[model samples]
Target: MDMDIQPPRRTFIRQMAASGALLGVAGLSGCTASGVAEEVAPGFRHGVASGDPLADRVILWTRVTPAHDGEGDVAVRWQLATDAAMRQVIAHGSVVTSAQRDYTVKVDAAGLLPGHVYYYQFAVDGGDKSVVGRTKTLARGDAKQVRLAVFSCSNYPAGYFNVYADAARQDNIDAALHIGDYIYEYESTGYACGQAEALGRVSEPRDVLLRLEDYRRRYAQYRADPDLQAVHAAMPFIAVWDDHEFADDTWRDGSVDHKTSQYGPFELRKHAALTAYHEWMPIRVPDASAPDKIYRSFDFGGIVSLHMLDTRLIGRDQQLMLSSYYDEHRRFDVEKYKHDVCSPRRQMMGHEQMAWLEEQVSRSTARWQMLGQQVLMARMEYPTAVVMGECSPTNYCALKKRAEADPSCVNEKEQRWLSAQTLPCYLDSWDGYQADREQVFAMMRKHRKNLVVLAGDTHNAWASDLRDAEGRQAGVEFATASVSSPGMEGGYPGRDPDDVAAMMVDLIEPLYYAQTSKRGYMIVTASHEQVRCDWRFVDTVFQHEFTAATERSLRVLPGPGNRRIEECYG
Candidate 1:
């Protein structure tokens, strides 16, 4: 467990109580998402938002709960301010939000100063306003410096998002490139979270999400997190989606989480997920990358070109399962060959996306070209050597997972009795899709050399020096770590996550520096010379007050072969 203590909803209520007293406002806990909870409408219910910044202007988004309550439209006035408070207004206007878009409103505030910070908020009923949101316009493409906070795979019920909270505190970051999985499809405690599921933090619907309402409830719950809210309030975010935002390891047609008719048809489920994802997230409509078109690009002062790729929708091949592994002992018959590494035309990013990615890489003139996308571009291999007596993430974590097999009778409450551990490899990630990995590496080599890959599907931190098609280190570097909704490798019961990660890294020989069973985020800094990355981990996430530190520091020098591990533990 990330923390022995579960999320303290009562603590939040208490904090609200104190803050409410300070502001002479009432703590409104009884309000529903459909209607206003209190007579007082103080600023942002969802908090401030800023995005899609050009040199002069940026996109602004907000929602207003109505007095006709959930059903009626609320005409809200928005104002951009130079000060943190709304005393000085730069641009002011009015927009109406109705039930059509779930009372959400988005407006692009253009014609502002370049490379400058601006504060904006919304006033509902032309009176009460939202929390001030701070945003910055980009410098010209040729500008000298820019930093990015890259992340993905954040499942709210998984744990406290100290990663997002920490990234919010980072220095000099221009924007955040969230490469998907902002929301997950699981409705209950679908995965092993760091805390007890009994916490109201349990994802709503109490099962796998299928209906639009289920998806919406999930988003509202995630957005209710104060840390995630603070990060969004603090900076402009650019995002794309990965599978869990729809379903675990999803593709155009289905997902790993998909079942038969009870969840509805796969297409309908996908449609519902995408519809809700588009509506709730601070993303633009008619995203070009659809089937669930969340992929897009962002240029940072033109010095660094961020090419966001959509790896899931158009070209995703079906995920590999345990069936892909057959015993080499020839002890089993033909049915044993089911999991025989299905490389038969499987893809992580389909052909069209591959071509699009290649074009973007080739066209970039920036000093650093970052492939900001979901999933790792590297082909991680399985650990052929399994220590006979040990099991990791534990059979307990994996056992409880309906993923490979059903939960055994092992009681997690009896965790103290276990001794030693074993490690089995996950068949997801790049390790599951070898052919797709080869194609992407080929593109990186052919189109560009100064490339760095950022990923967040797996939860533990990794630093890999990617090799070219010829097995020569391609000067391309991959920095991927664990999830917002973490997958295995977090170690459980008898396994110390660090020791288990140690055995796996040794067997697979991935170019990883530090892997922790901890929670936190990555911070990236790019100059013309080098791109520096820090894997920051929090001491504990479920606790409100936790210390964060650098678990590892790595660097990819510009024009590279492999990223050099620099000041690893510093």
Candidate 2:
């Protein structure tokens, strides 16, 4: 396979525009009849978006670029209507945006009817208008059904955002749920940039993001993506940030990717990232004083209570690394590693967030308790050798065959390797914080809630049965795949993705389904009876032309004792 070949930027953009993607700035520009360059007008070039919806309101956002640099603050007007033509306006407002806000405007339009759709648009004093945006308010009394389009790990330079585009065209989707990794902070040459240059998808600024302006520029670049703009324009988004939004493997105070010696201080970087995030995303700040506190709950009538959590930034302790448990002889101390990982002092969500979650869950009378979080909360334990990548799928199959053929043929060392104790593969997930996970399970069990967890960040689709340390069923988790980032297939070169996925399911007891190599999203539907998740995959992200299909569907029924995933029938 030729890895370097990719479609040209102009051709890609043209095809995307034809296929319903928003036109790139270059595509939107043109010359006059006399051949003189025509100046682009000042308007809402970044497109309009709405998010963080409530029963009575939704946040609307847009960015107005001045015709020239150094222009003073720009006055913008906004209107919300029940019709697309903006003739029957229900709410209208005006705001002033300056360079301090990066020329971005956000408005929380209130006085909306519950479970209703509204059309919104922004304009300048001279009558320049933005693309009309569509958003829906949450249901207030009785929502028999609510559907959400879930997405994550959208690396702009990796490939086209066909997943977002496909979801934009779908019907009956109440809103979009961006669990995390909304914008990656890597440089153009970092991570999954193998074909970025060929596809004309290079990251702007050409460097790793650090300061306020750097983060803002990255957000601008991503929002300018036609597919991304189309999705934001089509539906409201409920978002929370994962590690890549700030830095990879981010904790409360620092990250593995950050170097204080070079980047100065992690605190300043975090502040800048958060500032840019708040400015660009249409999210309602949970607290005006503490911008970092973004963990909040949303109720859909009496059917579901969706709790979006902040597992990366606010209260997470440093993640545990297995390499740190190596002894003098280069032997791993598994017992010690387990003990440290099970320590009660280790926190994933701090005391304050946990208390708040308990209160929300306890007070809600909804039929379903859905946690829209960033990381997996299920037990994904594999054999130590497999977790450490010492045993490939092919190798494991061969060993199993030999062991079944003759017991005496396998040596003691091989037996130990084959029957190795199981452990979590990624310490960055909830598996690393067993004590904290158990605390959450205890709270859910106490409230007798029918838990359905929606998670992303693995860049792979997964369905797992969540279990507590006591081996009791806790809930079911549906983890969506990445929008473009590579999955487990990237880690194992030349291996079949299907084989890898099968091996994972065979080794991990809690994992019911897994797709290791795919770029896609999931649609989670909640009702009074059950919650169903359908994983949808795009055929290709390397090109604008593509097809989307439902790869898998599973559901969990509302129960007093049972809370496990089962195949969705009919």
Candidate 3:
């Protein structure tokens, strides 16, 4: 793959203009050329996007790259219309952009009506207009159905963003939830193989992103993708970062992948990545001083209220490692392990965020309390006996070797259960934070909230019951599969994903559905009565053209007694 930072090919405007043909707004008229509508040209190559929608407003975004390199601080004008023709002008404004902010422009278009679709566009004084983007504000009152296209972990080098393309084509999706790893920091040749060349895709810099410019260029490359742009142009995106936006397995202050000798100060690198992330992603922060403030809430009328959490950076304690348990004696003490895991000092969302979350659940009047977060909240513990007794010797040996390398692979209970053996419990996820997980479940139990968790980062579909300390059903979690990243099946070659899923279901009492062999996103439809989540998988990512199929659908009725999840459709 080439290391060159390719210029935006103006593909979004050229290709989407045909599909998103606009006549003008309903009542207001935009600037015209000789009393005629001019075609969008290559000026705003990165296209246009809208996100972080509120009841009466939305954040509009665009990047203005001057045809010449030295032309800085280009003046760009924008407008919002009630219709596609640019007739019903709702709002209009102008913003200046320069290389300082990577020429990206964002405006919070406020005072618009609630639960209404709006069309928006951007253009320079004499340059071509940008591709018209469609966005919708959140429904305020008496809302019926709300559809959200949920996606995450889209690795540029891994494969095509066919899931995003599929999402762009969906008419029912009112908004989208991008719950982390929107852009991976890995170099082009580092993460996955074959797909890059197969799809002519390569990440910029050709090395791990560590500097501010590195992160900026990477975002430009990702946003340049037509599919991603189309999805953003189609609907507003509620996004939150998980790990990869900065570095792999990032916490509050550091990342496991970062080395001072290689990446300078971790704080500097993290700040750079975050600055670029906020600039590129169409997100709004209440306080710029708090750089890692993506944790926010959104209300979808009375149907659901989404609490987007920053599980990677905000208030997360250092992740526990299983390797700490192994010693020269090779003796594992179960009591010591339990004491360490259940300690009150360890935290996931931190004390403040957890308190805020509980408050959100307690105060919300919405029928469903939706938590849009990164990493799976459901307990996905490995059943060592299943692998040791049923799996092939090769698979068992492989897993055992992996466990030896990372002791955090297994939890205290799983470690005890597999005393002499290994029962890996993907420690990077919520499974590793058992005490904190229990705290969250306790909050749900206290509030009697009809909680529905939306998670990513695992690159696999999981539908499970969230149980409280007393083994009572507290809520239900729907962990959406990744947009492109590989899953456990990819790590364990030759192992059957379905077989592993079946074993997990048998061992993990709360789990009802699981799939690891496919790559796609989830479509969540919420109403006052119930919320339906459909796990849809892309047929193939190696090719440009692909199809999507629903792997499964789980429906949860609000104000539930036990928060039961019924498998509805596929």
Best by TM-score: 2
Error of 2 at 108 (Å): 0.8
Worst 10 residues of 3 by lDDT: 27-36
TM-score of each: 0.81, 0.93, 0.87
Writing each residue's lDDT as its tens digit, candidate 3 over 342-391 gives 67887788888888888888888888889999988876655555433445
Better of 2 and 3 by TM-score: 2
lDDT tens per residue, model 1, 1-570: 123122332322233224431121122253454224455453455555677676788888765645444566678788898876456897999898776666667887988977887878777764676656778888775677787777766776666777776666565678887877787776564575436364336666577788777776677666656567667767788777888877877876888778865676888877877777766666665444554655556667767778777777766767655543446762333233323433647777777677777777778777777878777655454322232323432443443343235335555542332322222245556655666677766666676557778877776667776764456665544454543555444334466777666654644444565474666567788877678887667666565566667656677776544444444333
Give candidate 1 misplaced runs (Cα > 4 Å): 1-28, 33-43, 68-70, 193-199, 286-291, 324-344, 387-426, 476-492, 560-570
Per-residue lDDT, model 2, residue 358, is 97
TM accuracy, model 2? 0.93
Better of 1 and 2 by lDDT: 2
Measured with C-alpha atoms, the lDDT of residue 504 in candidate 2 is 77
Ranking by TM-score: 2, 3, 1
Model 1 global lDDT (CA atoms, 0 to 1):
0.64
